[model samples]
Target: MDVRPAAEADHASILAIVAPILAAGETYAIDRDLDETAVHEYWFGPTHEVFVAVSDGAILGTYYLMANQRGGGAHVANCGYMTSSSALGKGVARAMCLDSLDRARQRGYRAMQFNHVVSTNTRAVKLWQSLGFEIVGTLPKAFNHPVHGYVDSYVMFRAL
Candidate 1:
Protein backbone atom coordinates (compact mmCIF):
# COMPACT_ATOMS: atom_id res chain seq x y z
CA MET A 1 0.00 0.00 0.00
CA ASP A 2 1.08 3.56 -0.68
CA VAL A 3 0.49 6.17 1.96
CA ARG A 4 0.71 9.80 0.87
CA PRO A 5 -0.54 13.26 1.63
CA ALA A 6 -4.08 13.86 0.50
CA ALA A 7 -4.95 16.15 -2.37
CA GLU A 8 -8.14 17.83 -3.59
CA ALA A 9 -8.73 14.98 -5.99
CA ASP A 10 -9.02 12.63 -3.05
CA HIS A 11 -11.90 14.50 -1.47
CA ALA A 12 -14.76 12.48 -2.84
CA SER A 13 -13.07 9.23 -1.98
CA ILE A 14 -12.35 10.45 1.48
CA LEU A 15 -15.99 11.33 1.99
CA ALA A 16 -17.05 7.97 0.68
CA ILE A 17 -15.24 6.42 3.60
CA VAL A 18 -15.97 9.05 6.23
CA ALA A 19 -19.63 9.78 5.62
CA PRO A 20 -20.96 6.34 6.47
CA ILE A 21 -18.87 6.11 9.59
CA LEU A 22 -20.12 9.49 10.69
CA ALA A 23 -23.70 8.58 9.91
CA ALA A 24 -23.38 5.43 11.97
CA GLY A 25 -22.28 7.44 15.02
CA GLU A 26 -19.98 4.63 16.00
CA THR A 27 -16.34 5.64 16.55
CA TYR A 28 -15.73 9.31 15.87
CA ALA A 29 -17.29 12.05 17.98
CA ILE A 30 -18.22 14.22 15.01
CA ASP A 31 -21.71 15.47 14.28
CA ARG A 32 -23.91 13.01 12.45
CA ASP A 33 -25.69 15.73 10.50
CA LEU A 34 -22.64 17.40 9.04
CA ASP A 35 -23.10 18.40 5.43
CA GLU A 36 -20.52 17.72 2.72
CA THR A 37 -18.96 21.16 2.98
CA ALA A 38 -18.56 20.93 6.74
CA VAL A 39 -17.23 17.41 6.53
CA HIS A 40 -14.75 18.46 3.89
CA GLU A 41 -13.58 21.34 5.95
CA TYR A 42 -13.26 19.21 9.05
CA TRP A 43 -11.21 16.61 7.25
CA PHE A 44 -9.05 18.94 5.23
CA GLY A 45 -8.86 21.92 7.50
CA PRO A 46 -5.62 23.88 7.95
CA THR A 47 -4.85 22.29 11.32
CA HIS A 48 -4.52 18.76 10.05
CA GLU A 49 -1.96 16.83 8.07
CA VAL A 50 -4.23 14.55 6.14
CA PHE A 51 -3.13 11.37 4.42
CA VAL A 52 -4.53 8.61 2.32
CA ALA A 53 -3.62 4.95 1.93
CA VAL A 54 -4.06 3.70 -1.59
CA SER A 55 -3.63 0.36 -3.25
CA ASP A 56 -4.14 -0.29 -6.96
CA GLY A 57 -5.36 3.26 -7.43
CA ALA A 58 -8.15 3.03 -4.90
CA ILE A 59 -8.24 4.72 -1.51
CA LEU A 60 -8.32 2.16 1.30
CA GLY A 61 -8.13 4.50 4.25
CA THR A 62 -7.50 8.06 5.42
CA TYR A 63 -6.16 9.70 8.56
CA TYR A 64 -5.32 13.11 9.96
CA LEU A 65 -2.56 14.03 12.40
CA MET A 66 -2.30 17.23 14.36
CA ALA A 67 -1.15 18.73 17.61
CA ASN A 68 -2.90 17.34 20.66
CA GLN A 69 -2.99 20.84 22.04
CA ARG A 70 -1.44 24.21 21.43
CA GLY A 71 1.46 26.11 23.04
CA GLY A 72 2.64 23.95 25.96
CA GLY A 73 1.24 20.79 24.38
CA ALA A 74 2.48 21.22 20.82
CA HIS A 75 5.10 18.54 21.27
CA VAL A 76 2.48 15.85 21.44
CA ALA A 77 0.44 14.65 18.46
CA ASN A 78 -3.17 13.57 18.05
CA CYS A 79 -4.70 11.60 15.20
CA GLY A 80 -8.00 10.35 13.78
CA TYR A 81 -8.21 7.40 11.37
CA MET A 82 -10.90 5.94 9.13
CA THR A 83 -10.72 2.86 6.97
CA SER A 84 -13.06 2.20 4.08
CA SER A 85 -15.84 -0.12 5.16
CA SER A 86 -14.75 -2.55 2.49
CA ALA A 87 -11.12 -2.46 3.61
CA LEU A 88 -11.50 -3.74 7.14
CA GLY A 89 -9.23 -6.63 8.26
CA LYS A 90 -6.89 -5.99 5.32
CA GLY A 91 -4.21 -4.14 7.31
CA VAL A 92 -4.91 -0.74 5.73
CA ALA A 93 -5.36 1.06 9.04
CA ARG A 94 -2.23 -0.61 10.40
CA ALA A 95 -0.09 0.59 7.53
CA MET A 96 -1.43 4.15 7.83
CA CYS A 97 -0.75 4.19 11.58
CA LEU A 98 2.79 2.89 11.13
CA ASP A 99 3.36 5.58 8.56
CA SER A 100 1.84 8.20 10.86
CA LEU A 101 4.30 7.28 13.60
CA ASP A 102 7.26 7.79 11.30
CA ARG A 103 5.80 11.03 10.04
CA ALA A 104 5.12 12.18 13.60
CA ARG A 105 8.74 11.57 14.60
CA GLN A 106 9.92 13.44 11.56
CA ARG A 107 7.73 16.36 12.62
CA GLY A 108 9.38 16.39 16.10
CA TYR A 109 6.43 15.18 18.14
CA ARG A 110 7.34 13.71 21.53
CA ALA A 111 4.31 11.48 21.83
CA MET A 112 1.02 10.55 20.17
CA GLN A 113 -2.35 10.65 21.85
CA PHE A 114 -5.82 9.42 20.96
CA ASN A 115 -8.31 11.47 22.96
CA HIS A 116 -11.55 9.55 22.59
CA VAL A 117 -11.39 5.94 21.56
CA VAL A 118 -14.76 4.26 21.90
CA SER A 119 -14.39 1.13 24.01
CA THR A 120 -16.73 -0.81 21.77
CA ASN A 121 -14.37 -0.42 18.81
CA THR A 122 -12.37 -3.42 19.95
CA ARG A 123 -10.52 -3.97 16.70
CA ALA A 124 -9.05 -0.48 16.83
CA VAL A 125 -8.39 -0.76 20.57
CA LYS A 126 -6.44 -3.98 20.07
CA LEU A 127 -4.62 -2.62 17.08
CA TRP A 128 -3.54 0.48 18.96
CA GLN A 129 -2.35 -1.69 21.85
CA SER A 130 -0.37 -3.93 19.54
CA LEU A 131 1.19 -0.82 18.09
CA GLY A 132 2.44 0.11 21.59
CA PHE A 133 -0.24 2.50 22.78
CA GLU A 134 -1.33 2.39 26.40
CA ILE A 135 -4.76 3.16 27.70
CA VAL A 136 -3.87 5.97 30.05
CA GLY A 137 -7.43 6.72 31.10
CA THR A 138 -11.05 5.86 30.48
CA LEU A 139 -13.99 8.25 30.47
CA PRO A 140 -17.13 6.52 31.70
CA LYS A 141 -20.05 6.52 29.26
CA ALA A 142 -18.33 8.89 26.91
CA PHE A 143 -19.58 7.80 23.54
CA ASN A 144 -23.22 7.47 22.56
CA HIS A 145 -23.07 4.58 20.19
CA PRO A 146 -26.02 4.19 17.84
CA VAL A 147 -26.74 0.57 18.57
CA HIS A 148 -25.08 0.12 21.96
CA GLY A 149 -26.33 3.29 23.66
CA TYR A 150 -23.80 4.83 26.08
CA VAL A 151 -20.27 3.39 26.18
CA ASP A 152 -16.92 4.24 27.69
CA SER A 153 -14.10 5.90 25.83
CA TYR A 154 -10.37 5.68 26.35
CA VAL A 155 -7.41 7.98 26.18
CA MET A 156 -4.56 6.15 24.47
CA PHE A 157 -1.02 7.37 24.37
CA ARG A 158 2.41 6.35 23.11
CA ALA A 159 5.81 7.98 23.22
CA LEU A 160 7.19 8.64 19.84
Candidate 2:
Protein backbone atom coordinates (compact mmCIF):
# COMPACT_ATOMS: atom_id res chain seq x y z
CA MET A 1 0.00 0.00 0.00
CA ASP A 2 1.09 3.55 -0.64
CA VAL A 3 0.58 6.39 1.81
CA ARG A 4 0.63 9.87 0.32
CA PRO A 5 -0.71 13.36 0.74
CA ALA A 6 -4.32 13.58 -0.38
CA ALA A 7 -5.48 15.56 -3.41
CA GLU A 8 -8.87 16.86 -4.36
CA ALA A 9 -9.44 13.80 -6.49
CA ASP A 10 -9.44 11.67 -3.33
CA HIS A 11 -12.17 13.59 -1.59
CA ALA A 12 -14.98 11.30 -2.70
CA SER A 13 -13.29 8.22 -1.33
CA ILE A 14 -12.40 10.05 1.83
CA LEU A 15 -16.03 10.98 2.32
CA ALA A 16 -17.11 7.44 1.63
CA ILE A 17 -14.93 6.18 4.47
CA VAL A 18 -15.77 9.00 6.85
CA ALA A 19 -19.54 9.17 6.37
CA PRO A 20 -20.43 5.87 7.96
CA ILE A 21 -17.94 6.32 10.76
CA LEU A 22 -19.47 9.65 11.67
CA ALA A 23 -23.04 8.50 11.08
CA ALA A 24 -22.52 5.51 13.37
CA GLY A 25 -22.11 7.97 16.23
CA GLU A 26 -19.86 5.52 18.04
CA THR A 27 -16.55 7.38 17.93
CA TYR A 28 -16.04 10.92 16.70
CA ALA A 29 -18.16 13.85 17.87
CA ILE A 30 -19.22 14.68 14.33
CA ASP A 31 -22.85 15.39 13.63
CA ARG A 32 -24.83 12.25 12.86
CA ASP A 33 -26.59 13.92 9.95
CA LEU A 34 -23.65 15.89 8.71
CA ASP A 35 -23.97 16.98 5.11
CA GLU A 36 -21.47 16.34 2.35
CA THR A 37 -20.47 19.97 2.07
CA ALA A 38 -19.75 20.18 5.75
CA VAL A 39 -17.85 16.93 5.72
CA HIS A 40 -15.75 18.25 2.84
CA GLU A 41 -15.07 21.44 4.70
CA TYR A 42 -14.04 19.57 7.80
CA TRP A 43 -12.01 16.77 6.25
CA PHE A 44 -10.59 18.30 3.08
CA GLY A 45 -10.69 21.88 4.15
CA PRO A 46 -7.79 24.29 3.76
CA THR A 47 -7.10 24.43 7.48
CA HIS A 48 -5.79 20.88 7.83
CA GLU A 49 -3.49 18.52 6.01
CA VAL A 50 -4.77 15.08 5.00
CA PHE A 51 -3.16 11.88 3.81
CA VAL A 52 -4.48 8.62 2.41
CA ALA A 53 -3.39 5.02 2.19
CA VAL A 54 -4.13 3.36 -1.09
CA SER A 55 -3.65 -0.11 -2.52
CA ASP A 56 -4.51 -1.19 -6.05
CA GLY A 57 -5.79 2.30 -6.74
CA ALA A 58 -8.37 2.26 -3.95
CA ILE A 59 -8.13 4.31 -0.81
CA LEU A 60 -8.33 2.15 2.29
CA GLY A 61 -7.79 4.72 5.00
CA THR A 62 -7.07 8.36 5.74
CA TYR A 63 -5.86 10.73 8.45
CA TYR A 64 -5.84 14.47 9.02
CA LEU A 65 -3.45 16.54 11.11
CA MET A 66 -3.56 20.12 12.25
CA ALA A 67 -2.56 22.47 15.02
CA ASN A 68 -4.43 21.58 18.19
CA GLN A 69 -4.65 25.20 19.24
CA ARG A 70 -3.53 28.65 18.28
CA GLY A 71 -0.61 30.80 19.48
CA GLY A 72 1.31 29.08 22.29
CA GLY A 73 -0.56 25.78 21.91
CA ALA A 74 0.19 25.36 18.22
CA HIS A 75 3.32 23.37 18.83
CA VAL A 76 1.21 20.41 19.79
CA ALA A 77 -0.58 18.63 16.93
CA ASN A 78 -3.97 16.95 16.74
CA CYS A 79 -5.05 14.16 14.41
CA GLY A 80 -8.02 12.04 13.39
CA TYR A 81 -7.88 8.66 11.67
CA MET A 82 -10.35 6.51 9.75
CA THR A 83 -10.24 3.27 7.85
CA SER A 84 -12.78 1.61 5.64
CA SER A 85 -14.85 -1.00 7.48
CA SER A 86 -13.50 -3.68 5.15
CA ALA A 87 -9.96 -2.50 5.78
CA LEU A 88 -9.85 -2.92 9.54
CA GLY A 89 -7.30 -5.31 11.05
CA LYS A 90 -4.98 -4.91 8.05
CA GLY A 91 -2.66 -2.36 9.78
CA VAL A 92 -4.11 0.52 7.82
CA ALA A 93 -4.88 2.60 10.87
CA ARG A 94 -1.53 1.81 12.42
CA ALA A 95 0.31 2.79 9.27
CA MET A 96 -1.63 6.01 9.04
CA CYS A 97 -0.93 6.80 12.69
CA LEU A 98 2.78 6.20 12.37
CA ASP A 99 2.78 8.42 9.31
CA SER A 100 1.01 11.15 11.26
CA LEU A 101 3.55 11.06 14.06
CA ASP A 102 6.44 11.26 11.63
CA ARG A 103 4.76 14.08 9.81
CA ALA A 104 4.14 15.90 13.08
CA ARG A 105 7.79 15.66 14.04
CA GLN A 106 8.93 16.79 10.59
CA ARG A 107 6.58 19.76 10.88
CA GLY A 108 8.20 20.72 14.20
CA TYR A 109 5.46 19.66 16.56
CA ARG A 110 6.77 18.89 20.04
CA ALA A 111 3.95 16.48 20.85
CA MET A 112 0.68 15.07 19.66
CA GLN A 113 -2.59 14.87 21.52
CA PHE A 114 -5.93 13.22 21.05
CA ASN A 115 -8.38 15.33 22.96
CA HIS A 116 -11.25 12.90 23.21
CA VAL A 117 -10.97 9.20 22.61
CA VAL A 118 -14.03 7.15 23.44
CA SER A 119 -13.18 4.60 26.11
CA THR A 120 -15.35 1.95 24.55
CA ASN A 121 -13.22 1.98 21.40
CA THR A 122 -10.79 -0.40 22.96
CA ARG A 123 -8.98 -1.19 19.75
CA ALA A 124 -7.98 2.41 19.21
CA VAL A 125 -7.08 2.94 22.85
CA LYS A 126 -4.88 -0.13 22.79
CA LEU A 127 -3.30 0.87 19.51
CA TRP A 128 -2.38 4.28 20.88
CA GLN A 129 -0.93 2.73 24.00
CA SER A 130 1.18 0.36 21.95
CA LEU A 131 2.48 3.31 19.97
CA GLY A 132 3.64 5.12 23.14
CA PHE A 133 0.69 7.35 23.75
CA GLU A 134 -0.39 7.55 27.37
CA ILE A 135 -3.79 8.20 28.75
CA VAL A 136 -3.18 11.60 30.26
CA GLY A 137 -6.69 12.27 31.49
CA THR A 138 -10.12 10.75 31.52
CA LEU A 139 -13.24 12.85 31.43
CA PRO A 140 -16.18 11.09 33.02
CA LYS A 141 -19.04 10.47 30.63
CA ALA A 142 -17.46 12.67 28.03
CA PHE A 143 -18.85 10.67 25.16
CA ASN A 144 -22.42 9.52 24.79
CA HIS A 145 -21.86 6.29 22.93
CA PRO A 146 -24.94 5.32 21.00
CA VAL A 147 -24.88 1.69 22.08
CA HIS A 148 -23.09 1.88 25.41
CA GLY A 149 -24.81 4.84 27.02
CA TYR A 150 -22.40 7.34 28.53
CA VAL A 151 -18.75 6.38 28.36
CA ASP A 152 -15.58 8.03 29.56
CA SER A 153 -13.34 9.80 27.05
CA TYR A 154 -9.59 9.82 27.32
CA VAL A 155 -7.09 12.47 26.45
CA MET A 156 -4.10 10.66 25.02
CA PHE A 157 -0.69 12.22 24.39
CA ARG A 158 2.88 11.41 23.39
CA ALA A 159 5.97 13.55 23.08
CA LEU A 160 7.80 13.68 19.78
Candidate 3:
Protein backbone atom coordinates (compact mmCIF):
# COMPACT_ATOMS: atom_id res chain seq x y z
CA MET A 1 0.00 0.00 0.00
CA ASP A 2 1.10 3.55 -0.65
CA VAL A 3 0.61 6.01 2.17
CA ARG A 4 1.15 9.63 1.24
CA PRO A 5 0.04 13.17 1.89
CA ALA A 6 -3.51 13.79 0.81
CA ALA A 7 -4.29 16.04 -2.13
CA GLU A 8 -7.36 18.28 -2.51
CA ALA A 9 -8.94 15.73 -4.84
CA ASP A 10 -8.73 13.08 -2.14
CA HIS A 11 -11.42 14.74 -0.08
CA ALA A 12 -14.25 12.67 -1.50
CA SER A 13 -12.52 9.39 -0.77
CA ILE A 14 -11.75 10.55 2.75
CA LEU A 15 -15.38 11.41 3.31
CA ALA A 16 -16.50 8.04 2.03
CA ILE A 17 -14.31 6.34 4.59
CA VAL A 18 -15.45 8.58 7.46
CA ALA A 19 -19.18 9.00 6.88
CA PRO A 20 -20.17 5.49 7.87
CA ILE A 21 -17.99 5.56 10.93
CA LEU A 22 -19.58 8.85 11.92
CA ALA A 23 -23.08 7.58 11.29
CA ALA A 24 -22.42 4.54 13.47
CA GLY A 25 -21.38 6.69 16.43
CA GLU A 26 -19.34 3.77 17.65
CA THR A 27 -15.79 5.06 17.69
CA TYR A 28 -15.18 8.71 16.98
CA ALA A 29 -16.78 11.48 19.07
CA ILE A 30 -18.12 13.35 16.07
CA ASP A 31 -21.80 14.08 15.62
CA ARG A 32 -23.41 11.48 13.40
CA ASP A 33 -25.48 13.89 11.37
CA LEU A 34 -22.70 16.25 10.36
CA ASP A 35 -23.07 17.58 6.84
CA GLU A 36 -20.49 17.03 4.12
CA THR A 37 -19.12 20.55 4.50
CA ALA A 38 -18.58 20.22 8.23
CA VAL A 39 -17.16 16.74 7.92
CA HIS A 40 -14.83 17.91 5.16
CA GLU A 41 -13.62 20.79 7.28
CA TYR A 42 -13.11 18.58 10.32
CA TRP A 43 -11.03 16.01 8.45
CA PHE A 44 -9.14 18.28 6.08
CA GLY A 45 -8.85 21.35 8.24
CA PRO A 46 -5.66 23.40 8.31
CA THR A 47 -4.68 22.33 11.82
CA HIS A 48 -3.86 18.76 10.82
CA GLU A 49 -1.81 17.19 8.08
CA VAL A 50 -3.88 14.47 6.45
CA PHE A 51 -2.71 11.39 4.59
CA VAL A 52 -4.25 8.56 2.64
CA ALA A 53 -3.30 4.91 2.36
CA VAL A 54 -3.88 3.74 -1.16
CA SER A 55 -3.65 0.36 -2.88
CA ASP A 56 -4.52 -0.51 -6.45
CA GLY A 57 -5.66 3.06 -6.95
CA ALA A 58 -8.15 2.86 -4.09
CA ILE A 59 -8.05 4.77 -0.83
CA LEU A 60 -8.05 2.11 1.86
CA GLY A 61 -7.41 4.23 4.92
CA THR A 62 -6.55 7.71 6.10
CA TYR A 63 -5.07 9.52 9.08
CA TYR A 64 -4.35 13.01 10.33
CA LEU A 65 -1.45 14.12 12.49
CA MET A 66 -1.11 17.37 14.38
CA ALA A 67 0.26 18.90 17.54
CA ASN A 68 -1.62 17.64 20.56
CA GLN A 69 -1.58 21.16 21.89
CA ARG A 70 -0.05 24.51 21.06
CA GLY A 71 3.13 26.14 22.41
CA GLY A 72 4.39 24.26 25.48
CA GLY A 73 2.80 20.98 24.43
CA ALA A 74 3.75 21.17 20.78
CA HIS A 75 6.34 18.43 21.09
CA VAL A 76 3.55 15.86 21.37
CA ALA A 77 1.59 14.77 18.33
CA ASN A 78 -2.05 13.73 18.11
CA CYS A 79 -3.68 11.63 15.39
CA GLY A 80 -6.97 10.24 14.18
CA TYR A 81 -7.26 7.27 11.79
CA MET A 82 -9.98 5.52 9.86
CA THR A 83 -9.96 2.53 7.54
CA SER A 84 -12.47 1.67 4.89
CA SER A 85 -14.78 -0.99 6.32
CA SER A 86 -13.97 -3.35 3.51
CA ALA A 87 -10.29 -3.01 4.25
CA LEU A 88 -10.48 -3.91 7.93
CA GLY A 89 -8.25 -6.80 9.07
CA LYS A 90 -6.07 -6.25 6.03
CA GLY A 91 -3.41 -4.29 7.91
CA VAL A 92 -4.45 -0.94 6.51
CA ALA A 93 -4.62 0.73 9.91
CA ARG A 94 -1.36 -0.79 11.05
CA ALA A 95 0.45 0.51 8.01
CA MET A 96 -1.02 3.99 8.37
CA CYS A 97 -0.07 4.17 12.04
CA LEU A 98 3.52 3.12 11.39
CA ASP A 99 3.76 5.75 8.68
CA SER A 100 2.31 8.38 10.98
CA LEU A 101 4.82 7.58 13.70
CA ASP A 102 7.74 8.04 11.31
CA ARG A 103 6.19 11.18 9.89
CA ALA A 104 5.65 12.57 13.40
CA ARG A 105 9.29 12.02 14.28
CA GLN A 106 10.52 13.56 11.05
CA ARG A 107 8.36 16.58 11.83
CA GLY A 108 10.00 16.94 15.27
CA TYR A 109 7.29 15.58 17.55
CA ARG A 110 8.75 14.00 20.68
CA ALA A 111 5.70 11.96 21.56
CA MET A 112 2.31 10.80 20.31
CA GLN A 113 -0.98 10.82 22.18
CA PHE A 114 -4.49 9.60 21.64
CA ASN A 115 -6.69 11.70 23.88
CA HIS A 116 -9.97 9.85 23.68
CA VAL A 117 -9.93 6.22 22.66
CA VAL A 118 -13.26 4.61 23.28
CA SER A 119 -12.60 1.66 25.56
CA THR A 120 -15.16 -0.46 23.83
CA ASN A 121 -13.20 -0.25 20.63
CA THR A 122 -11.01 -3.15 21.63
CA ARG A 123 -9.37 -3.54 18.26
CA ALA A 124 -7.97 -0.01 18.34
CA VAL A 125 -7.01 -0.18 21.99
CA LYS A 126 -5.08 -3.37 21.34
CA LEU A 127 -3.48 -2.01 18.20
CA TRP A 128 -2.25 1.09 19.99
CA GLN A 129 -0.95 -0.94 22.90
CA SER A 130 0.91 -3.27 20.60
CA LEU A 131 2.47 -0.25 18.95
CA GLY A 132 3.84 0.89 22.38
CA PHE A 133 1.17 3.26 23.61
CA GLU A 134 0.24 3.03 27.27
CA ILE A 135 -3.14 3.65 28.78
CA VAL A 136 -2.11 6.54 30.96
CA GLY A 137 -5.59 7.62 31.95
CA THR A 138 -9.19 6.64 31.66
CA LEU A 139 -12.24 8.88 31.56
CA PRO A 140 -15.23 7.04 32.97
CA LYS A 141 -18.39 7.30 30.97
CA ALA A 142 -16.81 9.77 28.66
CA PHE A 143 -18.26 8.56 25.41
CA ASN A 144 -21.91 7.98 24.60
CA HIS A 145 -21.69 5.04 22.21
CA PRO A 146 -24.83 4.52 20.21
CA VAL A 147 -25.06 0.82 20.91
CA HIS A 148 -23.28 0.54 24.24
CA GLY A 149 -24.56 3.79 25.72
CA TYR A 150 -22.10 5.46 28.09
CA VAL A 151 -18.62 3.95 27.89
CA ASP A 152 -15.20 4.67 29.28
CA SER A 153 -12.53 6.33 27.17
CA TYR A 154 -8.77 6.05 27.37
CA VAL A 155 -5.94 8.50 27.03
CA MET A 156 -3.06 6.65 25.42
CA PHE A 157 0.47 7.94 25.09
CA ARG A 158 3.94 6.97 23.86
CA ALA A 159 7.24 8.76 23.51
CA LEU A 160 8.67 8.89 20.05
Distance from true position, residue 106, model 2, in Å?
A: 0.6
Tens-digit per-residue lDDT, 4-105, candidate 2: 999889989999999889889999977888888888888876668999999999999999999999999999999999999999999999999999999999
For all the candidates, what are their Cα RMSDs to the real structure? Answer: 0.6, 0.8, 0.6
- lDDT score for candidate 2 against the true structure: 0.94
How do the predictions measure up, each by TM-score? Answer: 0.98, 0.98, 0.98
Per-residue CA lDDT of model 3 for 1-160, tens digit only, reads 9999999899899999988888888999989998889888888888989999999999999999999999999999999999999999999999999999999999999999999999999999999999999999999999999989999999999999
Model 1, runs deviating above 4 Å? none
Worst 10 residues of 2 by lDDT: 38-47
For candidate 1, give the lDDT of residue 30.
85
Model 2 pairs whose backbones collide: none
> Residue 136, candidate 2: how far off, in angstroms?
0.3
Error of 3 at 65 (Å): 0.5
What does candidate 1's lDDT look like per residue over 17-112, in tens digits?
988888788999989989888888888888999999999999999999999999999999999999998999999999999999999999999999
